[model samples]
Target: MLAWTALLVAIVVSFRPTVPVIWGDTPPFVESALLTLETGRPTVAGGRDPGYPALLAVTVAFGGDLSTVVRLQQAAWAVLMLALAATAQTATRNAAGLVPIILVALYPGLLLFRHVLTADLLFAVFLNLAAAGLLVANCAGRTARCCAVAAAVLCAAVAACLRSQGMLVPIATVLVGACVARPDTPARVAVIALSVAAALALLAAGSRFGASDSDQSSTVFLPKTLFCNHLNIVLASDAARREIVSAAGDRADATMARLAADFAAEPGRWPVLGFFGDACLFDAALDRDVADDTGNAVGAASAYRSIFLAAVRDRPLAYAGKFVHQMAYGASVAWPPYGLEPAIPVSTDDVPLVSDIITRHGRAAEPIDLQGGPVRIGLLSDLPGISAYLFKALSTAFVIAVLFWAVTAVWRRRPEFSARAGIVVVMWAASIVTAAGAHTLDVWRYLVPAVPMVSLMLSLCAVELAACLRRD
Candidate 1:
């Protein structure tokens, strides 16, 4: 009930018009939603996934404003996220498990994005729920297991539709389920194999059939073209084309067109095309520059594409070097400095405050401008820097601790701890590795879904630490 109250208040606060909210990828979503409402088509500025827009359209259909619907959903998800963290604690019998929820509640980055309309918050919620449900199902017997598997798969499918990263959960779930299922039991093995194959087939079909009108036909035809197809849509957009045109004048479209045509002409150029795509689309500095440029939003898009294309065409080595730099930077930090803002649109006057918070706190900076006065308070400032640093360091230590705990749990033939913790570790490791390998690693939003595993592991570590201290 307390959690529900907190979530309700947060949702109300998020709806306050005077709060100067920051929107990361939300403007495009709004555009898409409105477009879908108007024309019965999914058309966004950035050619984003249709999940959020579809959600908004349904809300609007029911006579709710976008802001009201979005804020309510976000708040509900945030509360649910906390509840999941608490449940994970109960499962592990760790009193300190609640600490992760508290930490997440105070996390400015998560708080900021929680109210936005991007897929990250929703993805995180569904992923965590799926994880928790799986844990519960595993702990219970066959009847509960069936329900749990269904819930897990449903949540994962929802997450996947919101963001491509969400597919990882289902994929990992299937893989782990298959590997761990008893081979001697032909029925179980066949069930697992059939389920996994069906899931994969559905994923592939969705990717192929669920494409929007704005999606580039060329890239969609190619296998292993996920990143490239996304890039092509981004590049083919009016904003991108306009930016190149403005930057290089007449040569802009021609140059970009030529580049696209060249790549299309030579299938061998796919690797080079991917390299350029990563540099232009994934670069943290580029994203930061786009965010910092407080001019017209379209102009910002144009400038970003212009800069990216120039970097790719003229200085390929420098572009690749920047990608490497961003990857290294992503691995070292607790959170990246980009993609912290809400996905909904914010006015020009609020850019500076948003920028300052994002830069200082990485993606965890959430500054709520109250209706009453000019007083600004950092929500997470209660923990001193040293203490926060120690907490984060301890979180990392917890990952290692959980590995040991999980190993011991397995050795003792406790499948509950072993399976749950093992799954968390696999997802965590996969998310980190995939993010690290990507061309742009600076956006912490991309890493949000994986944070739950980190939080869970950290909480486990904290419990273990407290236990050791008590014994000592």
Candidate 2:
């Protein structure tokens, strides 16, 4: 009853981005969906991940309503929150489920990604499901443990397919579960290892099934290309630049030199080094049309990889410093509510927001808009004054809660719950590093995955604290 009420309330309160949110990376996904529907094959293009597009195609095929899609997505997220809440309650064996469910349903920042056309909403759901599955597996009886582990791995595998960074989720799940399991439990270890291997195999199969067959294809996904691009900026010192040029040889030396010059003119621009700069070195590298008809995107990616590897090989310290800064930057402004295009009001005279929801090809991205007007949560957009303060306060509280749980659990020698806490900390840190490593910019949307993890884990900590107090 509480879960259903929360889902309905969340649907009503955070019903912004009702029209399919389309922008920069959205076209490829939309195109992929259309192609999938038309060709009856799970075809991926434009370096976009195929998981979300394929899902979108399949969903639309059944109902043909994008609004229905958003509602279903929100409900799915709500269901995951309910599951997480239930898991946390079971893990602590306490009356602490309601708070986590409420927090998840009411998270102001969650509103940002809920109804979008991106994979983030689904990615986050899968990750939380995996976390919940691990927690359940940790507490399950011997016979049920194996099944729980399998379910967790399946969730992690789906998460990985949705986004590249998700590949780490299965590993994290196994480690978190193992940490919580009884000592000398080799059977548990075997189960987890088998699950991890199965998940990896599934990911490999998904990639092959979704791979683009274009000869000029980079043969690599957009995520990896973006990653290599970020690495290119990290390797932008004069020595590194010269090394890259030398490595590229005459055929590509000029292009590499030009990129170096661009980096040199504004060092901060490449890695998004400073607080603010338009240093999209990564995007620029992606745009360098060095590939001909016979070329694979892999070759271009290889060039960037070579330079990045050489830089790390030659100057380890530089890489470390940049990496740390990038991670810090990523962690700083994780989930600001209104960064992705501040809500523009639709005047009676202006074009409807529904008409504007199409792709660059002018193809119908959302086909149908169920809402009357633009779905703008006015309080978020109009009053940016409190958003930062609220974000900071909540972020600080979450961090402190995580730290408190970690120290207390270690001091108490309580591995069961602490293992889950540790997983949260590690996953959050890992996500920050992944974002820092992959993107040139430090945008808040990039940290969407961390938001729910932090919230759910912190809520679990609160429950554990309650359990501890009760025992005392």
Candidate 3:
């Protein structure tokens, strides 16, 4: 009965919005889908991989507009809720597990996903699919387990195709599966070896999906030099960033000054400093200057990567410290805040792709403003935040307790540790690591994959706490 209620609420919440949030990023997706149809190649939304554009291409084939695509994403959101519901049910071992799932379903903030055109929502869909598949495989008998494992792997691969960082999902699953698979599991070493092989295969296949000639497609921020790599340069202290940008050939001083001023304007973002890289990233004048500086070849992207790598080599300790800080920030901000109402759109007037989007999706294409905003679902928007806080608190104790149980179960050669329990821990850890590695701060959408893990952990821990209190 609880599952049915969650399903009904999810369907209603997912479909409540009409105006898809059109923002600056909408054009590339529209353009890519059109291009994909015309060229028969897996065209990309700007520098993004083919996973999302391929999805848009299918929608285009169905004669659906941007509206159709957002609806499709909404449907996926609904499916995610159902998947989480099942996982939570298993975790809590009772109706208490449904609490988080129901809270997620009613959270008014999630509706905002319906307005954007990013691959993250779908990528998350596949991640949860893989997680649930892992659970099924772990519990299934021999023949069934083989089928489930294959299905999980294929799902993880499709996820990797959608977003580059998603490559970690399959790799994490393989590693964890090897660790927790039955003691007599055959060819355990072979499985661990296959993780590396699978990751390489996914990366190679992802690059061919018509992203861009640019060196930085689908890896966090695109246009390698300007966003993803350049941002890291900005993340450094003033001295470090100065030294890093000094590698910009002829424009070194000017590049350093421009970035310094950009960071100066924000003054508060800290680890979230990627936004400062955008002016240089999207400025046409800067692009022309860069082209002229390097004789108009692929020098700009190469230079960015070279400079970023140098920073890593020179300031390895600094970079490592920053990476750890960001990971902690990632854990806190991982809650999904997309709501049904429209958000304030970020301007993309400087971006060259705006005109192209107009041509592809018609005049209606707008920038993607997916930042957190209000929802039509009343105070329910607060539910996601509340649950997130509770989940984090619960997970700390849960993981520790589970670790003890797992060790004991292994030591005794007992079947006490359920496979479902093992995969949840692994996915939770992998999700946090992958999201942090994306090096993004404007949003934490990359962390969506970890949410199901958090929610399931919440269900399990919350129930356990209640039982303990009653017994005491």
Candidate 4:
């Protein structure tokens, strides 16, 4: 009942009139959906998986505006996520089932994005539902097991259709399920065979469809061209080329150039170094508009690549140094809410009370021109005091502890429960690794799916802790 109430409140709050107008991936998703509805093709300026757009298109076909339908769908999914959380709590025998409900309800990021037409919310919802099903299968083996496994696989496939990263969830689920199932049992074999066949069928279908289309081809979907084509595009760009050339020029003019270059370097390392440098320069350049006199965006991209490559060949160490620097810059946490607030004031004293009001109400705060917009004021930005530090430290510690406990539980026992839990952890970890590798680590929003998993794990840990206490 508490979970239901929390979910209801979340639904109400998510649809509040005063919610801020924040720029999220929702706009792109909406555009994609609209485009698909009109053109019979999935195309957006920024690359995206077609699943959510296609879903939206179906909803529009039934008679509704893109934004309205998508927002309604998002709200519905948010509620579903809450119910799944409750289910996870029951399945894991965790007393803290309400934790997922509360955390999700109160999280500013989740609240802000919950009703937005973006793939993240949809991906999270499907992923969590699949996770809940996997947990159920782990706990009970029979027809329920078969149903749970099938549900998990199907949901995971739906998730993957939205975001390529989601493919990891289904793959991880199948592997974990197989490992936990009794060896040579008919059920186990059936589960394994079904999952493997499903995956292969999806891949083959994707390949066939992809081959038929020329303009709509993505290297990401093709196994053979994936890495090379992606790398080639990055290197061939003018931005990277220019950076390479500029770096090479700097090396040629430097005194004792021969003495400076004493290291044995692989030819391949040069391109990698150039690629990293070009990527950094591209990111920095994007921060501000370049001079109009300098060629168009495409030309500039090509020039940047040339400069980047030249730099790599001339002074390998210096190029390598830039790569390390870029990685560090990319890895470091800049701020909690990326682009949430434009200027990070040393203190929020002078900011109007309207700003405060907007922070609370978010987009719902009336009058688009109001001082307070649905802009998030970070706790780090607002309260620099020890209290803020303590709260953050505790929250971080709790999350970390939950993760550690989950990892230990999975490692210590090869139980069915642990196997299912391990898959969730692995998927979360993979998302993190992918984000980190791509140098796109910005907001906690990216880690939203991990929240339910963490909550579920913590609830399980709490139950175990209570059991131990009772025994003692």
Candidate 5:
């Protein structure tokens, strides 16, 4: 009862006095949602997954405001946190059980994200839910095990559908499940494999036949090609560039040569492309960029992949060096300075305080003013330096916790501990790898999914540390 009360209070405090913040990407999702509602078909375009827009469309259909949508997401997040708390309770035999829930309640990052307009919050919730399910399936009895496995597989599929990065989580979960299942329990292993396979089959079928759009060609290759171009033009070695140029068919080689020359003259564009996250180099002034044109996009993506592979084959040393550097930069402790905007949209301007977002890209200036309500916290905008310092501190603590868990889990040979911790470690590595490969290492938002895992692991490590000291 007390735990529930604390969680309720945290939700109220964190959300009181609605602050509606909107991002540049916010409009595309709104447009997609509104379009889907009008057309009565799921729509995905401009490099976005259809799941999020479909969700927003449902909210719109039900006469729900943005605040309403946010509230629902918050509720779902609360339930997930509660489930994690229950898992912790079971893991520790009801001792130190509330630690995970309390940590989640007070986690500023999660709380702040609870109101955002992106699918990231949903992705994080599902990731944690999947993790909780894994815990239950591994540690519970027969009836509970069957139900937990079903729930875990379902959560994994939903998470994957929400974001491209989430696609591998279900597979990872099944593999981890197999490893952790008792030697005598072949049934559990079979259940895990079947669940994952079924989910993947469903997702694939939906993508192939669910939408009515004739132009429903896959957009998966867009990110791959962009990552390759960013890497080849900016990070790859002279030998690698030559290899790429050699492999780039007649049409692309000339552009590649020009990009190589420009890179030699001005290497600063590398960071600009990395941090700002625009595929400026892929199109360049003289080259074509990937786009919605199905055939052209596919061809361009194929060419880019070929060149990247060629570079990797010819200059493995250089590719390795760049990979390490980019990953480190992406996962760095120093928070890039930016104001954390509230989740409220710009239409509500009557609130006591508000943040104005102006978009002027060679057109009439359009401004969105989001209400920040009566009380405003400027922790992200007003005190960026302090925020960065605090983030760095928290990040350092997370690293320590992960290291402790990794060392202890291995030394103890506990499959349960190893499976749970290993899943998180794998996801964390995947996030870094994706960011590094896509040249988004400088962006902080890419690492948000890893935050909850960090908190969960940290709490478990603390509990273990306390137990050890008591024994001593």
Candidate 6:
């Protein structure tokens, strides 16, 4: 299964440019990588975790090129697919479970991310790894089970170090373990206790690497500015807006409320929710006024956070409804939110540090947009397909698959199938909460992890159905 998946990934990824695909945010990772290479310390200024850069640094250490890194990432994705495939097979003792993983791997939308330079790819990879490993561990011998649990914990910890949402990975593991572990066994209790403690410790350590709420510079600052823009659109009542703003203590000012209103009123100037692109911190003058009151970005963000929390508290049910709606919206996207522009050859000549490192290492920075990049249609050249329609069919099929699995699992009395679905749901929830939790806007990119997660769940469902129909 692993060999076949790897072959499929390689063949599909061959259409990608020979160079490593680079995006706007790609250089900071290279910055961190070069720093790690020179100093033997994993650190960067842009609030990025060391996990990915550390991985890139290892490639540098081995004199491996960025193109190699791209292939490695693709391979990592293949491993994730195989893990889910293995999960399905192990759960039902049937090889038919490989179907869903293959279907996921063949999805055209996901191929875009395979060779892209982003930590999100790896973060998702480690998370699914933990989920599948934990499920498999449920069926393992005592010694192997302990090792598997330990490995899953390590994967969850690495996932945490990769993204801020990584804290959710630990929770998914715990839930998955609890679902599949035998209740009466003292070892199960011991395993749960040890994993919880380990998860808590890793959560503490990993969070220190993520961007802080107080951080008002770099990428972390945008959420505060964006909330006002979204609020102007979501909350129609002036009185309600005032009540939320008033929660900010001395930091709240009439100007801040007015600025938010003003930005929303402007027709073409500011984006409503920044669903396509953020950094819309909308109007500069608006945040400037808000910032002026608090005397600095930090103070302004603190105030904005207060307003954010207050708005949630004021209409908790409304917030929950919005969250669910946004999750559905994000999941329904068939294509990536970004990276579809006509591609130019990727280059780092403008970024001296990254350029120098690439020059020395002989790595090519290539651009990849599905429409015009070096990526060839290869096998997909025949018919231009609508991704939306494809996704609709897949989603409908997935629902049917789940219904089948639920019936079979109940009739056959299989706890493992239910456990598999539980973990998948938890993982999906984690992504939604992580992306939308900041009280900003939601975009398709934030839900990149869902592509594989949904596949894993679908695989379990399909596997369960196959197991039910087969007879000796």
Per TM-score, the best of the predicted structures is: 2
Please provide, for model 5 over 1-472, each residue's C-alpha lDDT reduced to its tens digit, 9 standing for 90 to 100.
Answer: 6765665675455554333345554554555556566677766644555567778879867876566767777787778677767776666454465655564555555655566667777878887777777677767786567557667777777777667666667776666555544425666556666776777765664232343332212333453435444554434556545544444535455656555464454345446343322443333432243222343545545655655566667676655676777766544532222234322233233221112111111122223334224234323323445655656765676667667767877688545566666665665565346556555554566666666665556556667667678889
Clashing pairs in 6: 346-367
Q: Positional deviation of 139 in candidate 5, in angstroms?
A: 2.8
**Residue-level lDDT tens digits of model 3 in 167-249:** 67778866655544432445544443454466556556553333543222333234443334345544554544554455455
TM-score of each: 0.61, 0.78, 0.76, 0.61, 0.76, 0.75
Weakest 10 consecutive residues, lDDT, candidate 1?
A: 217-226
Question: In candidate 4, where is summed lDDT lowest over 10 consecutive residues?
Answer: 255-264
Write down the TM-score for model 1. 0.61
Model 5 reaches what TM-score against the true structure? 0.76
lDDT for each candidate structure: 0.51, 0.60, 0.57, 0.48, 0.56, 0.59
- Candidates ranked by TM-score: 2, 3, 5, 6, 4, 1
Q: Evaluate model 3: give its lDDT.
A: 0.57
Candidate 4, 1-472: lDDT as tens digits: 6655765665555444323232334444544555566666654423456677667667767865434554665565566656666566566555455555554444444444543446676777777776766677777756567666776767666666667655566676666555444336676667657766885565334322322221212212222112121233334344544543343343322311221221122224434233222232223232112212342443434443344354346555543454454333322321122223322222223223323333442323223232543434222223335433433443454455446556667578525445545655565554445433333233355556545555555455555556657889
**Order of quality (lDDT):** 2, 6, 3, 5, 1, 4
| Residue 256, model 1, lDDT | 65
lDDT, candidate 6, 76-117, per-residue tens? 876776677667677656555666666566555455566667
Q: Each candidate: RMSD to true structure? A: 11.3, 5.0, 5.5, 10.4, 6.1, 5.6
Q: Give the per-residue lDDT of model 1 (tens digit) for 347-450.
A: 44544544453344233333444334322212443334543564456455654666576666758754555566666666555454544433334445666566
Q: Which stretches of candidate 2 lie over 4 Å from their true place?
A: 1-12, 15-18, 37-41, 60-65, 93-97, 178-198, 208-210, 213-239, 247-257, 260-272, 275-296, 329-372, 378-383, 409-412, 430-432, 465-472
Clashes of each: 7, 4, 11, 41, 6, 1
